[model samples]
Target: MKRIGMLTQIFIGFVLAIILGVIFGPSIAVVQPLGDLFLRLIKFIVVPLVLASLITGITSLNNVNKLLSLGGKTIVYFLATTFFAVLIGLAAGFILSPGKGVDIALPTESAEKAEAPGITETLLNFIPVNPFESLTNGNILQIIFIAIAIGIAITTVGEKAKPLADFFEALAQVMYKITGFIMKLAPIGIFGILAPIVGNYGLDILLPLLKVILAVAIGCLLQVLVTYSIAVRTLGKMSPLAFIKGIAPAGIVAFTTASSSGTLPVTIKNTQENLAVSKEVSSFVLPLGSTINMDGSAIYQGVAAVFIAQFFGVDLSMGQIVTIAFMAVVVSIGAAGVPGAGLIMLTMVLQSVNLPLEGIALIAAIDRILDMFRTSTNVIGDASAAVVVQHQENKASLAKSA
Candidate 1:
């Protein structure tokens, strides 16, 4: 008898979820607790995993210049690829015209408008007044800041910091063990998580917003298939097919969870095992990308903005379209890497272009469906960045050896 591959089992789980959900309908909600347990297990790993992995990753660097070089390359990769992501998103919007002849009734209550955080305030928030509080609060950006600062300080202290570094390194190993156990439960968790969603979101609810869904789907597909493929190949010097296959597990988890941040551990694990990224690089790049590189959300915001404008019969000016691109890029980079970031980005983009905020209500109805698609894309983009930067680091290491 042949043993089934892990991805194959997961695919089976996904297929079963759809089949059962359709047959059982809303009754499938009963299994949600199984999914919640899995989510809790994963969430339990997130804080400690991030803190320990990042701290060790930094200490391994052993020098500021190397750390700076890695950070610079990671940031540049994010910004450059994001430019193409936004362009692809906009192209999807223009071609699809998703809003044409579609009428979405705004909720009786006004859609809540989201306030964009100021750059200064957002940057300042990164520095945690109490690192323990940040950890307890699960503030990822603050945690990253804490980990980097501590890691850098440890690097400066040399051998004196060895005890602390050893502690974190050990902790990182323990977290990895825990993640492995949790991931074995993935097929079951995925079944539990997806069945209810499939049961709840009937075709009737999804039919009207079908175009909006298609536009976002097409945009995300292009970003992954086109943009990230070229990136991992030309810049990263890896086969695109291999890159896609290596990252598939992370993408599936992201789609089910609809959370790039929550899927960080899987991303790290996939890169290390499947993509050959070093622990040091994956730890830093994947975490930072979770918070900073929101290519998927940017795509959703782009398509939604165009849909809103067209739905209202508002003709978006050339300047407004450019502004949408600018805001999508900036707000995406600036977003706090939380669940509702898509709405926040959309609100800011629409407001900047003088489109009505009420359009948000229409999209909010089918937001979860859109989220599944975007979240998968976001994780894939995150992994691609990890691959590209790690490839650069590998090249640098080879050059040094030579």
Candidate 2:
């Protein structure tokens, strides 16, 4: 038999895992340790990867103006795509009305509140008290901040920084190799991670809120397929099909793992190798995008907020819908790049529109299932943004040369 591609292997493994999960039930959970090991391995290398790649990319630029310009463009693209995602989510919720006929029992107590840090607090936290501490905590945003600062400082130091810059460049290369090694285990890891989830929940949990789940899934697909495609085609001036094909590996990993950070290594590698985006752009944009470019979560928040309101038979005013959109954009920025971080941010969105906090309990059961889709969407958005920004930078460079 001809060899199957890695993507096909992962997809097959995923489908079989679900089948076995439905048949074997939670007994399939025995292999969960393999998944946990995969997650741990990814997490183990992320900090160093981000640290080395960002610093090396930034220092290599050797031009503060270019760095700032790229940063501005990246942030603008992220915000714009995120806003579009929110609008898509709102449309999905309004059209699908996922919560209209559902009657789920509210929990006795509210879901454990994972209060998102205030905007001001989040900004302040970016400046780490000790950079080493941030590394230890695996604080991605903070690490990016510190990495850029170090890179800027290196640029100012001129020739004196060559050794340090080369050292980090080498480190980044090493991490990429290590990432490849870890990714070899992806099919097994995906099986291990997904089997238990499908086994535990089965179709039973899905029946009650199937509409809501479908709405979220549809919204995510629209964002990735429609919204990001437009950006890639028009803005990035690249083939949408090519862009999707290039990022497929990262997207698959993101789907299986349901983590932006967990899939970062794969994302960076694919962006650089497959998409041919410069390391400078991929390193800076992908990491920043992972932290803040949560188009998928924003879409989910819009859908969930509206679903919750509809479930409770509450008619939201135009003002409340607008508030949900605004809050979704803002809260998603502070959302951590981990599994289920969006749930906490969803609480804030619920409160913005005077929706009941208890509504979260209704969706909590299947959040993981939905998370897998949204997380994949988020990674795609990040990769798309990187491609767009890289195109813009190349155009600018060509114009300057002319």
Candidate 3:
């Protein structure tokens, strides 16, 4: 038989896993370790991949001003898209009202409460007290900070830094090669990760929350299809269809994994190779986006917050809606790229608007399914942002030449 493509293989595995889970039920739990191993393998390379790729990308810029300009544009695009994502989510929540008639009893386990740190503290935390500690802790923001600092230092030191820069450049290449080897195992990994989820949760758990799930799904689709498309076409001057097709590989992996961070290697590869975004751009934009961009998470938060409020018959004032919107944007920035990180941030968003924290129990069961779609959307947003930024840079370069 002719060999199946990787994407096709993953789809088949996903379908089979779900079917087996449904037919065999908890007996399929035996496959859970396969999934855990896959996750562990992905997590194994993330810190190093990010650290090496980021430092290499920054040093390659060779100009401090360009680095700063790219950073500014990337952040602007991220924040703008994120703000729009929140609005879209809120609109979907209001219209769909997923929480209406959700009569499920709140779980007996109390919701874990975590206070949102002050903005100043968040900013300060970005700078690692000890770079080694940051790496050991897998503190992504701190690692990015140290990487940028080291990259800039290499640039400032001029000729003296070339050897170090060259070393990291080589390191990045090796890491990419390693990533390629890891991705060859993606089909198996995806199967391992998804099988247990299907087996344990099954369709029954998802039935009651179907409306809320559908609302969040639609909202995420809108952000990815409509919002990002408009930005790419109008600002980036690129065909959105082409953009979407190019990033599909990464999107597939993201959906299966439900992890932006775990899917980083694939995202970076697709953005660089398929999307034709420059390595310098893809390397910096994607890793940073993975760390900070939470468009999908922001949307989920908006939808969930409203869903919970409506479920409890708590009337939200106009001011409260505005607060939720603002909180969605803020909390999303702090959300890690791991699976279910968005749910953790949801607590902060709920608390901001004084929604019942226990309301989380209502939808916790189906979060995995919801997370798959949201993570895919998040990866698409990151890839799209990189393309848009690159397009603008080319336009500026041409204008300067003309």
Candidate 4:
């Protein structure tokens, strides 16, 4: 017999979990270790996966100056869109109130809510004085800073630094392989995790999950239909209908695979042939967008962070809200363009503001569902950047001739 697809397996597990929860009620908590074990496995990989992948990702860019000169328009467009995407997610979270009706126990430490840090204090904490201390503490933002600093230095030092860059690049591959291994256990983990949530809270808990799903789905649609549509029509001089039609093939691939990197060939092909982007423009912008542009993931993070906060009854202050948007954008720089990468990135968003990690399990069971929508949005966003950049370059060339 053929193997079951990962999403199918996960859906099966999700259904079974709810059934078990309803059947056994609170008694089903005995299987909780399955969830804990899965979480620990994910936690084991997070630090190394992020550190190595981030370092390699930055190192691969090699010359930051070269990127700015060649892909500057694409980069700025991506950054602006990503920032707006997060705000949209925040709005969806607050307005839709996805996590409002749920009541779950939070960790004792998390239960004692700390004062929200000021903007200055938040910035100061990102610069790990002792990098090792940050690693030991799992200070994600600091770790990202260290990775960026080291990666840039490696690039600046030139050929002599090849060995260090190679090491990290290889380590990143290893971590990715390990993460793939762990993800296979997701069905069991979801079963363990969700069963208890349903058992205690009853089926009403599933309503929030549905709302979470709706919020993210709506965000994805808005990003594509509203954000990218306007971007292509205004700056790219391409109609929204044309942009949507042209990018549909790649977007479908990205949605099914939930991996931006995996969908690049289709994206490049569609951007060039369908969208009329020059090969040079499509080649540079789409690939870079794949690595760093994550408007959809940003939206998901914003919604998930707010949902976690609400679920835990943790009141989010303005500073905390800003922190979520900032962290989502920053972490997007290093997030892997693979399936389920959002789950790991979500941890960073949660850690930024001291939200409970256990809340991850609450969302984990349905992550693949959200991943589909976000990955599709990400691919389309990348293609849209190519369209816009090609237009800007064309205008500049015409100006120079004149």
Tell me, what's the RMSD of every candidate? 1.4, 1.3, 1.6, 9.2
Question: What's model 3's lDDT at 109?
Answer: 68
The C-alpha stretches of model 4 lying farther than 4 A from their native spots are 1-68, 103-208
Let me know the TM-score candidate 3 reaches against the reference structure: 0.96
Using lDDT as the yardstick, the better of models 1 and 3 is: 1
Deviating ranges (above 4 Å) for candidate 2: none
**Which has the greatest lDDT?**
2
Q: Which ten residues in a row have the lowest lDDT in candidate 1?
A: 1-10
TM-score of each: 0.97, 0.98, 0.96, 0.61
Candidate 2 Cα lDDT to native: 0.90
Scored against the true structure, residue 111 in model 1 reaches a CA lDDT of 53
Give me candidate 4's TM-score against the actual structure.
0.61
Where's the lowest-lDDT run of ten residues in candidate 4? 107-116
Q: Taking the tens digit of each residue's C-alpha lDDT, what string does model 1 give over 195-221?
A: 999998868778888999999999999
Please give the lDDT score at residue 274 for candidate 4. Answer: 83
Model 3, runs deviating above 4 Å: 1-3
Please give the lDDT score at residue 296 for candidate 4. 89
Error of 4 at 363 (Å): 1.0
Question: Can you write out model 2's per-residue Cα lDDT over 1-402, one digit (the tens) per residue?
Answer: 128777787787788888999999989899899889888899999999999999988997889999999999999999999999999999999999999988767767657777777779988988899988999999998999999999999998999989999999999999999998998888888888888988888898799999989999999999988989999999899999999988987898898899999899999988998888999999889998999899999999999999999988999999999999999999888888899999988988988778988889887878998899889999999999999999999999999999
In angstroms, the error of model 1 at 344 is 2.0
Residue pairs of candidate 1 with colliding backbone atoms: none
lDDT of each: 0.88, 0.90, 0.86, 0.77
